[model samples]
Target: MKAKARAHANIALIKYWGKSDENLSLPMNSSLSLTLDAFYTETEVEFTNSINEDVFFLNGVEDKNTLSKISKFLDLFRIARNMNERAIIKTINYVPTAAGLASSASGFAALAAATNKASGLDVNSRELSTFARRGSGSATRSIYGGIVEWQKGINDKTSFAVEIDDASWDIGMVVVIVNREEKKMSSREGMKSTILTSPFYKNWPEDSQKDLKEIKIAIKEKDFEKMGYITERNALKMHATMLGANPPIMYFEPKSILVMQIVHELRDKGIPCFFTMDAGPNVKILCRLSQGEMIKNRLMEDFKEYEIIVTGPGPGVEII
Candidate 1:
């Protein structure tokens, strides 16, 4: 049997900006995301008594640190499968080796989904999502088909991500790769600093809750204007909170603003678009399905030097 599994990377609408428990990878608040077809990763897991330790080949590169990051998740899979400790996990990303795409989303999602099958656990999506959450808070959202929410489990059991919508409607993303070759800060470190030092971290509870309610309503009403604006604002505020931290850390760069302003200009031009960024220089722009082509053209007009990617709703895990 071919043990291959495929998972698509997702961009957060209400991002998981800070973590409460770094060791468990728990987040301070719930987050929602939409899986995108722009980038993805595929992985296969097989038991090999021959191998000494859990091994990982990322895009065919043998990296021990990769295995280390993935190591915490393996015990649960072994317990579920009732198997021995020895296994080899092989993963490949469809995206270029360094695209600044959220590989952890697709990477861990594929691992959880494939490991379940590899272990013969017969677990459902909820269980797999829960398992992935332990590895990374956002990983839970990646298991669902389309728009997904990672509900911050009060403990570990109750909090897990679930599918909220198919997002087959007029929704998509246009990623602006401002500096594909240069990464500013790591997401793990940025989130950690924001949690410990940022004064605004306290305000996140009230502000984010309000933002979440409004965005969900906008999505339900199919109000692209409200949804796009709210998403963009939330992303900006999340980065701003980092600046409030002691020895402040920020994800945005000079180019990030240029890209964001152009996205707003597109909205004014009647091709509604809004941008969101993670810990990298790239910005993922939210736009309607009907406006995807127009937005891409607008981006190309100004940013001939940067990569412009257009993608829409993507399915969750699938066998390849």
Candidate 2:
């Protein structure tokens, strides 16, 4: 059996910071995100008796570092279906690998979709989301398109993503690529450090839940300014908790702060834009579609050396 799938990367408006159950990939708080059309991953899976063990290839090259993790993830599916055959997984990522751009989200989402189809599991989207979560928590939301939310359910059965909006409106994002290098500390390491060492992390779950509720309402009302405000604030709060950690996990580089300042300056000039960051140095600007090019142009004037891409809402994971 063989299958191929594509899944787009997402930027969390309401971030997923900590995990309640690290082994199961259960989140400490619910998160909301917007799937972007610009960056994505495509994966192909083929099960064969010829292969003695699971094999993984990324970007046309054998990836030994990630093969163990991929094999463990595939085991979940094999156990579910009682299949003994190993599979070959080939994946290509359009997004940067580990620059806080949610590559893992799209990567694992595509793998989950392709594996589900190739193995003939034929599980629904909710069930598929749980499988993706075992690979990465954010991958759970990548199972849905446009605006999505991941509920921090107590268990695997209860935790999954639900679409909040189709995002067919004028909402979009401008991504500022400050650094494409793989991060020194991964999302998992950062989350564990923040949750265990940060004194400020105790309030993160409750605060993020409140922001999620408000942003959902803002999205429903089509209030762009309100949505931007909550998105920016929620991201800042997450970083603040990281800063409060014992070692102070700082993801911002010199240019990262510069990009944030530029966004704030543009907002002061009557442009309705807000900036948010993930676990790395890149910054994403939330804005209306009509103003995306204008904002991109303005940022270009200041950051001639950086790559800036504008993208709109993207689709959910699908067999391709």
Candidate 3:
């Protein structure tokens, strides 16, 4: 059997920084994200009786570390289907791998879709989200298009994501890629470090819950300013908790601050926009599609070396 799938990367507006159950990949708080068309992953899977073990490839390279993780995920699918045959998986990414972009979100979403179809499993998006979460927590949201929200459920079966809106109101994002290097501290390590050491992290879940509520309301009303404001604030709060860690974890480079200042400057001049950063130096500016070109042109002046990607809402996982 053979199957192929593609899924888009999602940027969290209300971030999920910690987890209550790390083994199940359950989040400590709910998160909301916007799936973007600029970055995605496509995966193909083939299962046969001839293969001795599972094989994984990324961008035409056989990656052992990535292979191990994919193999573990495939084990879950095999256990559910009660099939012992191994599969060969090949994945190609359109986004940067580990530089704070949601590459894992799209990567595993595409994997889950591909594996499920190739193995002849019949499951809905909700079940697919749960499977994807076992690979990456944010991947649960990536299983849906537009604005999706992941409910921090009490258990594995309960945690899933749903589409909040089609995001059809001319909304878009400009991805500012500052550093393409792999993050020094993996998200798993960073989250554990912050949870154990940062006093500010104690209240992050409560604050993020409030943010998720407000953002959903803003999306319902199609109020870009309200959505952007909450998103920016939520991202800052997430980073603040990291900074309060014992070693004062820092992810923003000097250029990251430069880009953020530019966004603030544009906002003051009556352009409705806001900036958000994840676990890396890159900053994502959420703005209206009408102003996307203006925002890009303005940033290009200072960030000629950095790659700026402008994209609108993307679709959910699809079989190709």
Candidate 4:
């Protein structure tokens, strides 16, 4: 059986910083995100008895470094479905890998969808989200589009994503590519260090929960100002926890700071835009779809050498 699927990348409005259970990829706190149409991953999976072991290819090249990880994830499907045959997985990522653009989110989500169809698992979207979570925590939310939240449930069965809004309104993002290189420290590594070392991290879950609650209300009411404020504040708090780690992990590069400053200046000029960052040097500006072009133009003046993409809400993971 063979199936192909596509899942778009998401930017967390309320960040998923730490994990409660590493093996299960359970989050310490619930997170909300908006899937972006600009970047995504498409994957194809085929189950065959002819192959002795799982083989993986990414972007037309055999990827040995990520083979073990993919095989382990595939094993989950095999074990659950009582299947012994290995599979061949091929994926292509449009987003920058490991640069805080949530490439793993889309990558694993696409893989999960394709694997489910290819293996005849026939699980629903919620179940598919949990399967994706085993690959990456953020992937749990990438299974859906628009405003999605991953509930930090007590266990695997309880933790899955729910769509908060369809994002049919004037909400969108402008992504500034500060550094596209693979990050030295991964999201898993960074979160682990912060959880173990950062004193400020103790209150992060509670704080993020409060933000999630308020942001959900703001989204339901269609209050762009309130949503933007909470989104920016929540992201800043997430980064603060990382900075408070024992060895002090800082993801912000010089250009990253410059981009943030420009966003602030734009806001002061009555432009309703806010910036959020993940575990990377890049910055993403949240704005109204109508204002995306204006925001991009203003940023382009300052970031002449960088690549900027304006994106809107994308669709959920779908078999293609």
Q: Give per-residue lDDT, candidate 4, residue 112.
A: 97
Q: List RMSD in Å for every model shown.
A: 1.7, 0.9, 0.9, 0.9
| C-alpha RMSD in Å of predicted model 3 compared with the true structure | 0.9
Q: Which digits, one per residue and each the tens of the lDDT, describe model 4 over residues 1-320?
A: 89999999999999999999999999999999999998899999999999898999999999989999999998899898999988899999988544778889999999999999999998999999999999999999999999999999999999999998999899999999989888879988999999999999999999999999999999999999999999999999999999999999999999999999999999999999999999989999999988999999998998898889999999999999
Model 4, residue 177: displacement in angstroms?
Answer: 0.6
Candidate 4 scores a C-alpha RMSD against the true structure in Å of 0.9
Name the better of 1 and 4 by TM-score: 4
lDDT for each residue of candidate 1 in 242-288, tens digit (9 for 90 to 100): 88988888667788888888887777777778899887878888888
TM-score of 1: 0.94
Candidate 4 segments exceeding 4 Å error = 96-98
Q: Please, what are the lDDT tens digits per residue for candidate 2 over residues 44-103?
A: 999999989888999999998999999999999899999988999999999844577899
True lDDT of residue 282, candidate 1? 82
lDDT at position 264, candidate 3 = 94
Poorly placed runs, candidate 2 (over 4 Å): 96-98
Task: Give the per-residue lDDT of model 3 (tens digit) for 39-102.
Answer: 8999999988898988889898987787788989988889999998998899999985458899
- Ten-residue stretch with the least lDDT total in model 4: 94-103
| Pairs of residues clashing in candidate 1 | 153-159
